[model samples]
Target: MTATGLTPSTQGAPDPASQAAARPTAHHPARAPGRLARSVRRNLTAHGFLIGAVVCFALFSWYPMVREFLLAFQKTERGRTTWVGLDNLTTVVNDPAFWQAWRNTLLFTALALVLGFAVPFVTALVINEFRHGQGYLRLLVYLPVMLPPVASVLLFKYLYDPGYGLLNELLRLLHLPEQQWLQDPDLAMLSVVVAATWMNMGGATLIYLAALQGIPGELYEAAELDGAGLLRKIWHVTIPQTRLILTLMLLMQVIATMQVFVEPFLLTGGAGPEGSTTTVVHLIYQYAFSFNNYGAAAALGLLLLVLLAGFSAAYVRLSRTEEA
Candidate 1:
């Protein structure tokens, strides 16, 4: 022991300043390489899994879109390709069918919104309110969607025939006027929309049904307590609750009906009487297949793509804003 009566090693506490100086910092330079290496390895593995999808999109989707764009600005003749600037676009824009196709497309979209959007929603509501036989009703509603497109279109064509069709026969039996369905230029587009709604509405109905099942029953109870009638309850509680799905479905219907082709092609020979049902997509098909003018087809298709893309972008922006 030292003469001061303390062990030699216990004579003084360690220096706090020296201990603090010896401690490691949170972001030590020596540990950075290991962390960076691990991050790079993880990213490489993730990208490896995405490689197949990237290749497929590049080969199929992106390449075709780019080719279509290029074809819109170029012409092929005598096994040669040459840039034609805006010639194809100018030709397409000048065609009278161009405006008619746009008008028909817009009309079809409007009709589809009314039928495709509302019918499914209302059907869903009815189906949801059912205390029994829900499964059977759902099956009946969805039966049409299971049919092949060609089969459904042909079936509707038979029904819309002016003479000897079941629909006309039913009208005769019911004492309703035997009006021309597909044969009438005025009603041709409407008939096509009806057939389309019948065939495609099952999907939307099922989607709406799913959404309806998620709604809280308390909302309805509160609406009832507030003396709301059926329609008022729907307007105040149901629509607001399902507004997102409704808007999304509305946009989807617009896009689908705008590009409608198969029903019109099969039912009305692509243009009906006086070119009534000639849609933009049908016109593109005519340009490409019937007239053998791929340049014009691509140009028209590019325009349609641009317009639809704008709508989609607007929807995306609105959805984002709502989320924010």
Candidate 2:
């Protein structure tokens, strides 16, 4: 033995741990180039998809918005485009139909809130209360939404016909007055609202029903134990539980109702009797297509965009504040 008490063979041998530490790992250096290439390929693929989406948005959405903004400031005359500054805005504001359209639009929104908003929620509540045939009920409610919008609107048109319409027939059977449904100036807007509600309420009803189903049964049980009736339970338990969804739906409904076009356009020919059902969107359509005033149309659209954006911002802020 040597002075250190080690055999000669052991003294020459290196420790396994030290040899391992000195050795190059299988995953390092040799595999690094392959790993780097794979990483680069993956990153490139992701970037390619992102770029395609950006290009699409730029082409379809952002481009149109920018074009509209530019068009709103410029006027075209005899195929010559000239920057008119706020002249387009002035023209839009000065149009006689401007105030009337705004009024009608506001009226439609209010009426829609009352009917379109309430009807769906009520329908959802009724459907939810039923333990059987819920699926069939939901299907029935959503059937209108599934039909083509034009078909649905045309169906309403036939129903609202002053003569020989099923509704008027039913009224006659009941010995009630057979009134002009769409022809009457006073009833024209209401008729359009009813048509819109029926056409659109299906989706909202389904959403509300889903929200209702998500509410814990224990909460309803608690409400019952507190001697709450149907309305009371809905007010205290249902509304609170689904407040967020309800608010969201309300905002969407308001935005949609404000921009109503197809129903009134198809049903009442855009401007109903005595211009009673003329909406902001209808006015925009008139400016763009009927009058061939692109600048005016863009200006009006810009105003609508601004109004909706401001309203959405306020709603979001208010909701956040309430949550806080």
Candidate 3:
């Protein structure tokens, strides 16, 4: 009411604090359609890739494996499938031919392991010891791996011809008996083993050579400085250094050789003169294709898968133990 306390114009006007509080807030545009469109596009992009990958794997790998597994319990008669349970497995196990095929596969694996395993390792070491022409030597050793198995098997078949083969001629020149390379029941497996070793050794030879290249030259040099002879250096330094690769190769060779097919299929008429060279794979072929027993073939195939699994498990455990 007093003149000094307040004027009429000030009393009627709005407060400064009230005017500041009445200011407008910020506004951002929310275009629902644009946000929705972007979200859908990104979601579709991610899910499309995921679905495509799964479909590819299912079509190529998973579906075939499932069918094969199911076939183990099924029989196909003129394109009709019927459930047979464990009958196929039992029948296969009871067959004398099954046992013979197993024996041949095992023997072939042994022979192959001997030649396939040792020859490559020894050859790799010899190549590694030299300080020159390693590239050329490696190529030469791996050359056989590039050859088609059919060509090599057929070539060996002629080389193994009974009377006129190069093998017989060489034996005659040395005054040795001209034994049948693939005719006799006892020697048929050996002939297959020889051909297999020749055909397969090249890949392993190069693998061993690569493994050998990783070993330090210093170890061998130190051993030599310590008056170690060639054999001693090899025994001490070389063996231990390349032991892992060697073990892995041996397991792989055993698993692969157990499934021997091409050499016997092409060279020996699928089973040789008798069933002497009939491998497990060849036997499976006989059951599935020749005999038309899909169930039994599946049973044998599943059995082979189990055997290979065992070998693989053992190798993996051994490698883990080595690392530990």
Best by TM-score: 2
Give candidate 2's TM-score. Answer: 0.89
Query: Sort by TM-score, best first: what order?
Result: 2, 1, 3
Taking all chains together, each candidate's TM-score versus the true structure is 0.84, 0.89, 0.82
Per-residue lDDT of candidate 1, residues 1-324 (tens digit): 567776455547778897899887687456688899999999999998799889999999999999999999999988899999999999999999999999999999999898888899999999999989999999999999999988998898789888988899999999999979998889999999999999999999999999998999999999999999999989999899998998888888888888999889988899999999999999999999999889999999999999999999999999899989
lDDT of 3 by residue, 97-123 (tens): 899899888998889888878988899
Model 1, residue 100: displacement in angstroms?
Answer: 1.0
Ranking by lDDT: 2, 1, 3
* Candidate 1 residue runs with Cα over 4 Å from true position: 1-49, 318-324
Worst 10 residues of 3 by lDDT: 3-12
Task: Pick the lDDT winner.
Answer: 2
lDDT of 2 at 275: 98
lDDT, candidate 1, equals 0.92
